[model samples]
Target: MDLINTCFEMCDYIEQNGVVRLAGNVKLRDNLKKELLHFLIYISMTDGRYGEEEKAFIKKKLGFDVSASMAADIKNRNMLGAGYITRVPETFKYFILANAGHKIKNDRYDNKEARTLAETYRKLGQEYLAANTGSTEVEINVLSSYCVMLDENLKSYGLLRPDYKSVAIQAETADEKEPDADELIAELNSLTGLTAVKEDVNALINLLKVQKMREQMGMKQTSVNKHLVFMGNPGTGKTTVARLLARIYKAIGAISKGHLVEVDRSGLVCGYIGQTASKTAEVIESALGGVLFIDEAYTLTNGKGQGDFGQEAVDTLLKGMEDHRDDLVVIVAGYTELMEEFLDSNPGLRSRFNKFINFEDYTAEEEVEILINNCKKQEYMLSRDALEEARRFFTERVANKPEGYANARDVRNYLEKAISNQASRIVGLKDVDKNILAMLEKEDLVGIEL
Candidate 1:
């Protein structure tokens, strides 16, 4: 292409997704990564063919590879994890510019992505120019224009992204190593719409840190209570944040292990006579040196018959707390009003689980983001029209504020239904491309009312 056309293409991207559109946008960051991969392909597919050698080259350099048939398509549009992108140093703007199943986000995000390509092109283009006597000036213009466009793209990507913030999170894989203290803290920050929870957790961490410092210097330590009361509707990340706190506790030397054990009323209480203490004791023993998260804890005390052994479980649990005061961190969770009543049921309970953190229902935007993230975890995307429908769906859901709404859990269930509809739409199709297979259209949501 001529310099005029080249400049036009470069200028077009600036306008398509400049500062306004690119700022703090997951979609645009993805676009930049896709463009980067395409640029890699542009230079590698010298004869316009994606061969095994080219594929191997990509696999060898990058941490991921694609099937032979998918070499050029699926590999080009892969989305790298946010941890890979945003975990780099401040010097690296940490943009997500490739999805090709490769681990390359720790790479420099400033100008290296463009400059490396430019240099490679310079070498390859020089060879071609030497053979064909092509215009050196044209090559110069091409590299210069690409570099300028890349800088602009990065600038826009950097506009709203300060240093590194959380990317919409996904489930951690089993093989992925556990995150350390700082990493756990970063993960907490990465969770969407947990502003108050994050603040409380940070404050607690800071206080623990200070207390540790004071004790080391032989100063008298202030009274501290790590046991917590988490009051929230279903699926508001009470368990998730509690798990992080457990790991954080271990990382900071507050606990011997960083594991999280979760249970509910049934996990504790028993129907057999005089067996509740033994059952609850086993559960407590398993959670020693870590965090034991109790969900719907109010059931243990609030609506029980006289024959019930819920009181035995409670007495056993309180004794365990006192016995393991140096290690065990108990976190009781349930709805706001019921949890308050649960605390009032026993004087011992009110004294131990004193700190309360409320988990609010997600707003419309956070719910939609959660929906999109859920799709990503399953290797799916939503069409622009579909996304608009989702935004509207969630907005209406939030406005109506449905009774018995399970915040994040509700979003996940809705996505499951949406994808089922997507499957039905594509089931009869003869061929499905990368884009077609991954996308859920607005029609998939049609007649699926709130």
Candidate 2:
């Protein structure tokens, strides 16, 4: 895989903050290489399958095939992380995480075994896959899981990411290219709808700027809670706005790094008793210097009562918020009524999150603008008739909008369906017409049900 080649390139030749040096050149005396191989095997079998794609990849790099017993051991054992990698030294810790920390099903993480330099990539991969799935949702993304682990490790090791092309530094890529406060605010204001949300964000930004200036002038300022509550339905750009806010905080030096770590109750509350606190703490640690955007935070306090362990997570989260008050901002979002109930359920939650911003549903015209924007992003165009049809479709849909309608998300689904319809119609054509391929006709939109 190309990733493996990049890792090799990094091993043979690399530069760290202007100093060029060869990494992984130090000799090792542990069973790190074999442990690393086993960790790779565990990640490859994550989805309950280890096909030829995985088998061949492992064999080529490790110089041996994964035996049947090894595969079974991976499946039978809880995971390969806790017992293998977290206890290693910084040299191997950095090496493992940089090379094998992240994985996607379609993407491959390949690297040669360089014993002289270091042979401990599996540690990162193992730490990532070490989340106790026994008590969490099955759909929790492996990539996100591993990424959170990698971030915690990076913070502990005091390391900075070199490049996005390098797997070891995946956490810092977003920050490296992040826009400043003005640019982020401009982007937020440029969204199709959410006029009220825009005004609210602007007012908050102004307040912070004045507060900073007052501090410079030796004027004592009251404590301001950076945490907020977002009241809106799904897909109303809550997460998007929260992400922009993170960068804005960083650009203004309110936070150390401006990364947004998004998670819901599923990412926080563990099924086990004492485990929930640690799990919640780990998630908070990853979000130390950024915003933690918790969607559907209402679920955590939905009358599940003390037995649910959701309360434990909430307690841990509150402690983390206070402990890292200077650097972390927490944004909890849900439907208007449910969010009210969530806040009502806890006194501390109500006190800490006094600022509330409501994201209104998009109007029909705004939905059409969103459609056009989506098309323009992918180099697709809607014919005049198609655009008019989209307008009518959204107008009627908005007039009779159902409960829990996902605003821009609905537009995205319609555009994707239109593309699929266009492909189906053009597939039988004898010649490939660039114009036909690029344009969405009226019938394409007409055929879409939503």
> Which structure among the candidates has the greatest TM-score?
1
| Clashing residue pairs, backbone N/CA/C < 3 A, model 1 | 33-97, 33-98, 78-99, 79-99
* TM-score versus the correct structure, for each prediction: 0.63, 0.61
Residue-wise C-alpha lDDT for candidate 2, range 1-450, written one tens digit per residue: 333344444433322322223357442322334544555655555556555545555676556586656776865673554343233433345454443533122222232222212212422332222322221122123322332333334423333221112221223564665454544554555566676676677656645654565466565554667899999887788987887788778887788988889999999988898998999999999999999999999998894655898888888998999899999999999999999999988899998999999998889998897888788777789999999999999998899987656888999899999999999989999887788889999999895775
lDDT of 1 by residue, 341-446 (tens): 8888889999998889989989999898778767877888999999999898888888888786778887888888888898898989987888888998999876
lDDT of 1 at 339: 93
Candidate 1 weakest ten by summed lDDT = 83-92
The lDDT of each candidate is 0.64, 0.66
In model 1, the Cα lDDT at residue 135 comes to: 22
**What shift in Å separates residue 96 of candidate 2 from its native position after superposition?**
53
- lDDT of residue 407 for candidate 2: 87
